[model samples]
Target: MASSSSNNTHGKNLRNAVVALLAPLPSIFFYLSFLRHYSAAAEAGSLSPLWTWCYHHPLLLANTLFFLNVNVLFWLIGVLQSSHWMIDLYWTMIPLLLIHYFSTHPLAQCNSWRSRLVILLTWVWSIRLTHSYFRREKWQWGAREDWRFSDMHQQYGQKWWWISFFAVYLAQQVFLMGICLPLYVVHSKDKQLNIWDLLASLVCLTGVTIAYFADTQLHNFVTRNERLKKLGQDLVPNLDEGLWQYSRHPNYFGEQLWWWGLVIFAWNLGCGWCFVGALVNSLCLAYVTILVEERMLKQQYRAEAYKNYRKRTSVWIPWFKTSLTGKEKET
Candidate 1:
């Protein structure tokens, strides 16, 4: 039995190593192809007008290439691991990469105070969120997948491989690019910093901090609850203290605030179309994310604790509270 167990462990480790080695190939290949194609087109000067136009707009070209590379890589990884959540790690990282690329690009007008501040805040937010996700996921190559993805695998069976490419990976890629649109606008034009820019910066930072602390509190609660459970103790189904007390989804609220800050920054630049990204992000968070998450929580807990918490706490707004009887109130 011991020898068999050891053999199984070794097999799993070998599979993980292999997957890790091959995971980055798709992105590397796509990036090299993009550079070569771009260089050849520039030298020939016979490329189509559309390709020529894309070359002038570095952000557009970069966004398209980056998205294509990452999306393909994600699908490849998912196919290898049979886990759709593999794409989740890059959700925060992609925006930061795009912002950094454009900010440092020669074509970018990123020397203004507003641009610098926005870049700094974006870095902070991205780093915090990435760190949180890394720790929470306890990610390792060839490890057990997220429960949600596991459920999807069971539901879709064999067809899940291709279905997830579109439903999960590509859909998330679209959302990510949309949310990062403000960075494109910010780098495209040279604009002086204004008071609104400062306000937006503050709001963005505040949202990041709020989300960080809320996640921390929830993590601690879960840790304690698990420890107690191991000791044969029963705890409540949901955490409703600290930041969770004010809002059932405080982290989601903070996320909305952070995205809305981008909207404000773009609006300050006098571009109305930039609002589309934040608007779409808001709808996704409010409708898709929260609804699905709450439903999952209810199904998992089954007890009345989560239901009661939902009734009393604000769904997305922290300040606005709800009553047990389904009445709205200002907290």
Candidate 2:
């Protein structure tokens, strides 16, 4: 009976994974169809005024497509799954979608090298994040939702059903699209690759490397502690090694660096406004970091150790640890 139950769960997860894989197809089809029709109309000089406007303004079309797919289709999937876990998976994928959308659109007028470089970098970053996500999920698709979402579910009770549309899906649309505005700018602008491009690429790659290692370290720590728990031994209280030793949230910092690094590419292309998305994302991360720390302090076994770790660690940017005073040492 135990074996049977495990098999059932595996079957459900496999089915969910297949559905999640195909969920974005419709939106992608629509966008490509729109582009094809727009191109035909442009050549014949018979384009509708609104279609002409859309051709000139690709970001507007991108966001509208994103809304229909995420806000509508993804929400329905979440309602069916009774869990918003799918969106967490989509978070790593949407940027890859956006980059392709911008690069393939008729209006794409970017330097060939820069466009290809950004797309390649995005693929690398996406792969790393998706792998981290699956590892965090223990390779079980849709088995668990993020802890923060679970907290909100409890906080709002029945009201969460409606509130989740705004709080979860819509909020993600804003942040995801905002941070990805650089993709559009990168494709729209035709500046030649320069020294700044090299610098931006370096920064972006460094961020991905840092985030990859930090997540791996944190995952190993949690896994080891879980093993100890199973053995009825005392679990390690905190992760104060590797990247966590220098910063309370090195992963968040690394993520921000990656986004901001892309913004540098946009800035070099004369689209400084692209920074808005990365900036907003950082601000949201700040709130999330505070919430995470508060939750950590609530843990009986982890609170004392985490409190001391927080005192000596930088909140975001990594640096050498601060020395503890005599009073702090005694405590």
Candidate 3:
């Protein structure tokens, strides 16, 4: 019976793997069709109405099409596999793709030092975050979905099929676009690199490094704990060393800092409105994501170790100590 169950699991994974490989073809074909139509219109003096509309509102059209493609992909994959975590793979990737698209546009003046700097920093940050997700989530062609999404599957039952489309995929699409507004602002202007750009770069680099270390430490700890569990030994509920000791969510803090650094870059270029994206992103991280994650950890562990860590460590800021009463105290 165990062997039969293992074979069934392997068959399901193989099917998912095949679906994942083929799913992106439609999106790619749509993009290519657009490019072909646009090129033909450029050669001729007249364009089809659809192409004309796309040309007039390139960014809006492109982003909308991308979002549609993502939603379709996720919906189909989710329905087939009864899982929504496939969308998580693209969460960090879409921003980088958008920035690359804008930065490489003819009107973007990609040659400017400022544009190059933003592109470079964004690429570094995106690649690091994506790699971290790949490692931590084991997000290969056919991997287990995240536990959170699995729980949602159980909670929502049949309704989760459609709900995942909006709640999981579309919601993330909106957040991704909003958080990446600074990339648009940076690419829109042909500004020279300034002192503020240097400072922003430093801040972004520091945040990326901090996030990298935090994830590394956490991953190592989890690996060790799993090994100990296999040996029937007790496992640690939470990590309290290195950056984890300073902040309950150091990786999250680093992520916010990185986005804020991008905001600083745009603000220095006089794009005050772009700050809205950064502000909203930070608020969501603080009030929504961190809160949900911590609540889950608290429930799952229900141990004094995690509770004490929560009491002493700042939730979203590193080195800002918290009192037992849950009030912030300057360290």
Candidate 4:
């Protein structure tokens, strides 16, 4: 029995490793092929005007590639898996890819400390997020889809097969590409590193650190509750300690800060338009937060506790709790 269990675990680990190594290849291949084809077409003067325009505009090219790779390819993969779980995994990876893509493009003009700093910070953010994702997933790939996607599946019924293309995958393309626009600006412009860059770096790093601790705390809380349930003990009603005490969703708050921090970099580079991405992301997160809180309230075991917790806690930003009577509560 022990030997069989050990072999099963080993098999699962090997399969996961293989999938990890291969999962990014398709996107990488598409990116390289895109650049190669663009070069050949440009050199031969065989490209149409629209294609030529895209070649000159790295942001446009990135979005086009994103459309094909994520909107089309990832959507198809999600259909095959009968789950949109893969997109959740890739969310932690896409920014990292975008940062590198912009920095390495033939038209890239960046070769400065700002570029290096942005890339390094992106790496840090990606690694931290990816690690949190895997930890939440118990190091398993695609074990279950996010609950919201599952809800949408049922809500949309048969229409989900098509609606998901736009609602899930395409919407993600818009948000992800938008939030990553700063990466393009960082690489496209050559600007001297300034106080703003220092400030942006600090904000980005702080966001990553806050998100790391918040997620760790939440995960530990959940794991402890699960263990208590198995031991036939009464489960904790709600998590209202640590960062959760100050805000209902510190993880989300941190994530918003990270993206907006990138926007600061672009804004300093004179592309304030990049704020659109961070703004859209914030709106999306606001919607998700509503859904999450609604779900929490529906849980009979902790509904009242969560309602009181909500009364006391700020929705996103960390702050001193409020009294149940809606006045500021001293912590």
Candidate 5:
């Protein structure tokens, strides 16, 4: 029994390591657009057509990389992390990956510099987020379900587990593919850089900064609030004490900005499908983030004080001059 458990754990560790190692490979191919007008320089006498095709069609490597780096690798994240919620993380990535494949032809888009830059930035973000999330969580694998999900399961009852699992899993897979459409298309196109790409990269950076700050602030708030609550004081404000003053979800705002920035980048590259596809992705993320995160915050607070904040704060869009839509002040 001991030997079997040890072997399992060792195998899991190997899998997670492999996943991490392969993390950045697929996006590389997706952004570079290696296949448009590809030709075999060598004479037919020297090399077979099949060999030449594979030689020039480097994106096939990316296709292989996807299965190795993403799809199959995520299973390892689940197995090694000991929490099925790791699977949730994996599910989240599916939408991003699929979005890339669907919105843009990986080999085609990478030809364009603007589109390629978008892919680079997107890949960087993914790698950073995935690594951070994996590292932060306890890796005991199956030891504990995420508390929020656990609570949800209890509320829903056992019958909902399978349904919930697949629902979220499938949704995330679809989402992953949808949002990443820009990079794939642009990279495959072999387009050039333009004004829009510059503007979009800035937008992406701004969104990332805002989202990072909001997330950090919220995490700190939760930690401090828990400590304060133990001593029995009125609940510490978790909402908009800082950037939250203007927007209910600073993080969501940033998140939306990032995707739109990608869209704009794709637009500069002259790819219609990628640009429009990224637009759809931006809309969905905004909707889901607001629904899931905003609702959770409101439910948790549920107070007259919170009502005041809600009334004053914009759900997402920042009010440039003032808060509360310039409506009457509430105490």
Candidate 6:
């Protein structure tokens, strides 16, 4: 009876804490995209037009400020996730301090509506994810960096995340401009929507849908199972039902695909190497997902059932399904 009461109390506390964290973070999720002054279309590789024009332009100061502040914001996100305040302070300030070293990069300019639009899109995505991170997780800092962050840190360390913060920002801003480059550079301004545009739109929508459902299902499973356990019921035998069939991580798969959708939109725009950024980014993310996710499952769920599931299902592609007999659908 006492144990059951304690579990109920824990669940209630977690629910309340998550709700408190979520209420304030969703509004600024979309604000970052709207702040940029240039479009992705103006990228000139040798600092010809893209870098020269924006850096000299006084109107783009906000864009510079935005880039600098994003690092700080990411640090704040780290704070909210960390259980300890001191660790939060250390992680948060390190990235923020590193920004000074790279704030003077040539690509840090603002120019067109397309650039602005892409910034808006990225901000919306980032903030949305930050919200999800705080609400979806239970422990504070040091519990585990988000596995994506953790693996990179373990593999690389603070210096890399530092280099990563600025290098990644410059590159993303560059890529953001590239994706929107066609919109800005092309004299025609083909904003009227084409097949690739439609596909990109659909891909993003599909991702949102999958993320929503996957999150819901996982949350329900945890809630229901926790409740059952508290009531002296047995643990669930398997989670091989909904999004668990094709791959263990439906949400991560959707996330990887969704970014590719952005790349496709960039491709249709006639941007050259910019699409390469998206492609490479997607591929790298897939590798991260596979490594970190498997590491986590290995730590938390070293069950025979999971071992069996791992044997047959493909990682990201839904090409195969695993049966209890260890056979997959015939290719």
After superposition, candidate 4 runs with Cα above 4 Å error: 1-23, 33-54, 326-331
Model 5 C-alpha lDDT per residue in residues 223-310, reported as the tens digit of each score: 6777888988867654666777778778778877887777776666666565565566667766665556555555655555566666
Clashes of each: 0, 0, 0, 0, 35, 16
TM-score of every model versus the real structure: 0.82, 0.95, 0.86, 0.89, 0.64, 0.55
| Model 6 per-residue lDDT tens digits across residues 85-176 | 22222222222222221232234432344444444444444544544554555433233344444445556654654554553344444444
Q: Write the per-residue lDDT of candidate 4 for residues 1-331, one digit (tens) a residue.
A: 9999978877866664565557667768866876787788868979766656756887877787778877887788778768877788889988999898888777889647888899999999999999998899888777678898999999999899889999888899889998998999999888788899999999999899899999999999999999999999999989999999999999999998999999999999999999999999999899999999999999899998887898878999999986565342332
Whole-model lDDT per candidate: 0.73, 0.91, 0.76, 0.86, 0.58, 0.49
Q: Write the per-residue lDDT of candidate 1 for residues 112-145, one digit (tens) a residue.
A: 7767788888999999897777667554444556
**Model 2 spans with C-alpha error above 4 angstroms:** 38-54
Q: What is the per-residue lDDT of model 2 for residues 139-243, given as tens digits with 9 covering 90 to 100?
A: 888888888999999999998888888999999999999999888899888987899999999999999999999999999999999899999999899998999
Q: Is candidate 1 or candidate 2 better by TM-score?
A: 2
Give the local distance difference test score of model 1.
0.73
Instruction: Candidate 6: list runs displaced more than 4 Å.
Output: 1-67, 72-131, 138-191, 228-234, 323-331
Q: Which candidate gets the maximum lDDT versus the true structure?
A: 2
**lDDT, residue 103, candidate 1:** 73
Ranking by lDDT: 2, 4, 3, 1, 5, 6
What lDDT tens digits, residue by residue, belong to model 3 across residues 94-188?
Answer: 77767766765434553377877778888899899888987885555446776667777789888888888777777776777787888888877
Q: Cα miss at 220, model 6 (Å)?
A: 2.1
Model 5 misplaced stretches (Cα beyond 4 Å): 1-83, 87-109, 112-116, 127-152, 155-165, 230-234, 275-283, 286-302, 320-331
Report residue 61 deviation for candidate 3 (angstroms): 1.1
